[model samples]
Target: MMNGWIISAAAEIFWREENKMAEARSLEEIKLDYAWKFGCGRYIQQREALETLPEEIKRLGDKPLIIAGPRAWEATEGRIEKALREAGIEYVLSVYPDQNTYEKAREHASQAVSSGCDVIVGVGGGRIMDQAKASAYFAGEMTKARSGHFPVVQVPTSIATCAAFAPLSVMYTQEGASLGSLRHNFEVNAIVVDLDVIVKEPARYVASGILDGMAKMVEMQNGHDNITIEEFDVGLVTAFTLAKYTMETYRKRGVQAVEDVRAGKLTKEVEDITYLNIAVAGVISGCSKGFGQTALGHECYELIRTHFTQEAKDFIHGEIVAVGQSMQLSFNGQEDQIPALREMMNSFDMPLTLKDIGIEPTEENVETLYQDLYHSPFVKDCPEEAEKLRKAMKWLCE
Candidate 1:
């Protein structure tokens, strides 16, 4: 009787697995037909290939407008001007004071429009690239009929987030705040990644980026019920693989990678990090269309309405996400993983908690996040997961 029962139970388990696999496969077939293209292109050699600008700039437009963060004012404006001049491409420069704020992007866009810029050249970090994208779209709001105007050439200083290379850009109202919103503003016409510039970025930014890259893989394992991506099986698996490789690289390298980057020691391994940071991640975001499939471990946008003081919002973008990921892991009954994660973060001295980021888990913040968790877009796609998220958030707060 026991043998018979065990055989029946084993058969039932196999049947369930078959059913779930069928569902996952069914979900994979649904793809998005849209105007977007992404991949790694000639990133490591853009600067040295300056002599070829005349032809490349010509492909983008006759007149190009340059948008850069304040930090890149000296580096980009002078170098870009020299190149554009050599190429005989008309150009103007718009410098944004801050990198992460939508208001700053809006400000720069307003300025760029006033100057009658037809094409955009984004030079700086992801924020500056995002700003250029938003500026390009917002400027031609009235005239952007079907095909958008203003081709944007994205040049990222730090291979942090691939926002610069995607059709969508993440906008923030201020720093240390909630990710304001993800807007489908501009598409990348081309990307110019000078590895030298990438290596110069701070180690902390690179470390935080490792966490963001890992999130793509971790979240994909628990697929979402809604917002399905076409050919998601391929896309998800590819993204997962890429993210896994990057995370492993960072784990093995630690601060040595960061130090090497700062010292301009761009090795093959570091080069791979840049590709994951800028190339593969961007391609995943663009082609995968896996928007709502991956459940955000951090209660999405809950911190926006109540927590995120002005000072906190001003902190680094990836840092906030890093802390949020830890909180999310705790909710998943994966607290055991926290020590390993913390050790990795400590390598770059990356913030691993809300307290580390200069924010406290106050009752008010908890309540707001608790309430917001139910209505989050990702949560609505999978209610069961949302419930788990709530449980997780509540426990973490406790």
Candidate 2:
């Protein structure tokens, strides 16, 4: 369904142009025509979740290309390889660089084509998941594929973000500014999460995952925070409801989830929290169109991410988003909820201030954040809005 109807290299050029054009357009102009890949990831949370991989892969493609970082591959390779071999499935293993960049996606896409791999399996956190999805999408343009993507299977090794279940890859510059998202009309062919594997990771991953999932509620509801839904996109309404429920669930059970993950034990709280981070948050992201799901908090993350790369070296996307959430809660005048959120973050050792993350609120740095927010093309340029961002960020740093 290309507008100009080209293929191969021509299609590739057209795709890049299309992305730029999308970035240029307003959210109101972009339309989604009934896009949902899957309800969420298929659930099989036992110690044997990898056992289902062979069946899932065979359902989509005969040859699979597994994408991962070295550590992620090392952690799950034994189980993953065992499952595939027993089922007589031939698979290719490719490791992405530690640097998550578009060029790497292009490199992997070319590999997918040359290796003749029919499906992609992302076997890690957000970076690997996004790269695999992006590579599959780009490979569709590289070839004359009908759906413009090879089927993707997501196997989440950590609960950092919902890239595993989201219909789009969160795009970023090599230097870490947001380039919006690479949205897919199709969903991943399947998703598999093994709790035993996920629980062994650091508790911070689970905590960060919770914060990232919570962003869906905070950012999406800034404009449409109404509980009594009247008239709207059914998908949008549905996503809002899910986020609300997820938030309440977190309020009740998230602490326990984090503690259990820290203790390297699987429990109901851990399971629900893990799914909320991947599936529920992902649905919220997939249902959102254009900037419909973005607001001051998310925008703040994009606007300031590159500023403190040194300080943020060990940081994940959700941790930075937590800082932005402060700006959002303040800017949107949702001040009453701040105390509880602040307390929770403090308890989890999550950053509640710029200093907490090793970022200084020096005059020069603070002004940069303020100026970027003030001049952002995404938001209305007004003194009041600028002041709010300033106040919010200032409070966060202080």
Candidate 3:
């Protein structure tokens, strides 16, 4: 009688466990029912790629508005004008200020509307593209235009960020502080990546871009355990594969590619690197839809930007992010990976310590940083993890 009772209890426990597993699987399937949208319908990346812009512009419309930064305009004005003239396409040019703010976006949108422009072409770095995207979006809303009818084309002058193909724009305050990001359903009509134009900039931009691309992969890898099997669809898998390719390309040919660009020589390696930096990086983030939620490195950046404005202004996006990645690795108790990460960053003169980013290792500053990190949304779901990250940051400063 005692043996029979024990057997009955074991079977009940096994049944309950199986039920729990089935429930979890059902939940994941429900989540997968939602679909994600991918932006940037067309991508033209190659040397002399600007030559292809006339065809793209013709497809969008006859009346086009060109939005660009002052310096970026100076660099590409000749090619753009020549192309437009040859194609007999009339365009209005609007040069935006250095800042990337909502007000600026609205101002550009007003210009696009008043000028009777049918298509918006953003020609510059990330900020310019972001402004153009926002302008096109708001312009369409104001005019009561159909969705996706008022198209925007992104022509990237630098590979610093994925703004060229991303459907979102990162907003900032008038004081040059980050406000957060804004998402739009509008898709970029096309992307023209002229390697000749991009290589004209310094090699530092390329290196920073590569690191930014790598960060997306690192974030995904760090949070792999949390992602469900249902989330591992073709888009997610392709994103992961692209991230890996970006890292491998950088490790194998990045140094020489930089040298070739510095010498004003555009090689196949440079073209491949640029492709990895812009398209691959952009697509990964676009498809994943912030799957890993930026992990520790980006969280640190947000904290510092919010609290230590003066110190944060001196560093570019990717430079500070590299330091944050190192801190994140340490936070996760993956100290063994730190040496290689630091070495790669150091080779490009990226910051590896607090002082490197212009922050003193004073106790007061460290405490402030810790407090900012503690209250960040990245740790909102798990407050205890914030403490762990704060300790890791403290050790980094020390």
Leading candidate by TM-score? 2
lDDT per residue for candidate 1 within 187-242, as digits (tens), equals 56677766656666777677666676766655554433322346455655566566
For model 3, the superposed segments whose C-alpha errors exceed 4 Å read: 1-35, 223-238, 290-293, 380-384, 395-398
> Each candidate's lDDT (Cα)?
0.57, 0.74, 0.70
Q: Report the lDDT tens digits of candidate 3 across residue range 53-92.
A: 9899888877888998888888774998898899888899
Q: Could you tally the backbone clashes for each prediction?
A: 8, 1, 0
Please write out the lDDT profile of model 2 over residues 179-262, one tens digit for every residue: 556676667778898877898988998999888778777777553336345666666677778888999999899999999988
For model 2, state the Cα shift of residue 171 in Å: 2.9
CA RMSD of all predictions:
11.5, 5.0, 11.8
User: Whose TM-score is higher: candidate 1's or candidate 3's?
Assistant: 3
Q: Tally clashes: model 3.
A: 0
How does each model score on TM-score? Answer: 0.77, 0.89, 0.84
Question: How big is the positional error of residue 140 in model 1, measured in Å on the Cα after superposition?
Answer: 3.6
What TM-score would you give candidate 2 relative to the actual structure? Answer: 0.89
Q: So what's the TM-score on candidate 1?
A: 0.77
Question: Candidate 1, after superposition: displacement of residue 95 in Å?
Answer: 0.8
Q: Rank by lDDT, descending?
A: 2, 3, 1
User: Model 1: which ten-residue window has the lowest total lDDT?
Assistant: 18-27
